[model samples]
Target: MNAEPEGLTGTIAIQVESDVVTSRQMVRKLTRQLMFSLVDQTKMITAASELSRNTLVYGGGGEMRWEIIERDSKWGLRLAFEDHGPGIPDVQLALTDGWTSGKGMGMGLSGSRRLVNEFELRTAVGEGTCVTITRWKS
Candidate 1:
């Protein structure tokens, strides 16, 4: 993502299933405001949904932070999901497609990374996890 978050764009807590849904809705609205294409909107919503679910389940719930960033003349949406659950033991293995730590298809990490222009994952055992991703408006 090219944009730098400037203001309070939005925020959602991933404590339950409903919050995950709300997170998707909020991102959809933000993407629309940024004039994201339909495809991009879908990608963003899907990515948000996946991250939110991950937080609720594996991370034992967390928070989702959204920001409408601006860089130079470009605009983008940035999302940061944080949790203090059992941090990922092997970040690299987790990023491998179809490699799951639990009962899942294992796309939550790698797939989400591919759906956006930028992806960053920070995790430590017993510490927490934070995954930030961004998609610039094209």
Candidate 2:
């Protein structure tokens, strides 16, 4: 999360609300470029929006890094939301549906994970957090 993951295609700072919207747009463009279906595009965009918002609100502003990757002749989009704010203390509690630390709808993290093909969360108390998600193009 510190050295900027290899093969980063782009990055968007999550400092303001507009940045979240921008992140969604970027993800949409990549999804379309990868020829993902309409439903898959929506899922990736929604997950990007939620995670980007979390990077802003919960992480107190961060950056969303993206990459286009390939595996076994299949293409995929990988996104990482990294932040340096106070890290999450309870990963399980945070991932539980209907559990929220603030006024959110309590589905950001869990829902985002459900929308993606792969989800990874790394956090350290007093350090920071990084959430990486990937969706393969079928």
Provide the lDDT at 138 for model 1.
88
Model 1 residue 46 lDDT? Answer: 93
Q: List lDDT for all candidates, in order.
A: 0.90, 0.92
Clash counts for all predictions: 0, 0
TM per candidate: 0.93, 0.93
TM-score attained by model 2: 0.93
Off by over 4 Å in 2: 1-8
| Tens digit of per-residue lDDT, candidate 2, span 1-138 | 123233449888999999999999888888888889999999999999999999999999999999998899989999999999999999999999999999999999999999999999999988889999999997
Q: Output the lDDT of residue 74, model 1.
A: 88
* Model 1 C-alpha lDDT per residue in residues 1-138, reported as the tens digit of each score: 323343447678899899999998888878887889999999999999999999999999999999888888989999999999999999999999999999989999999999999999999999999999999998
Pairs with steric clashes in candidate 1:
none
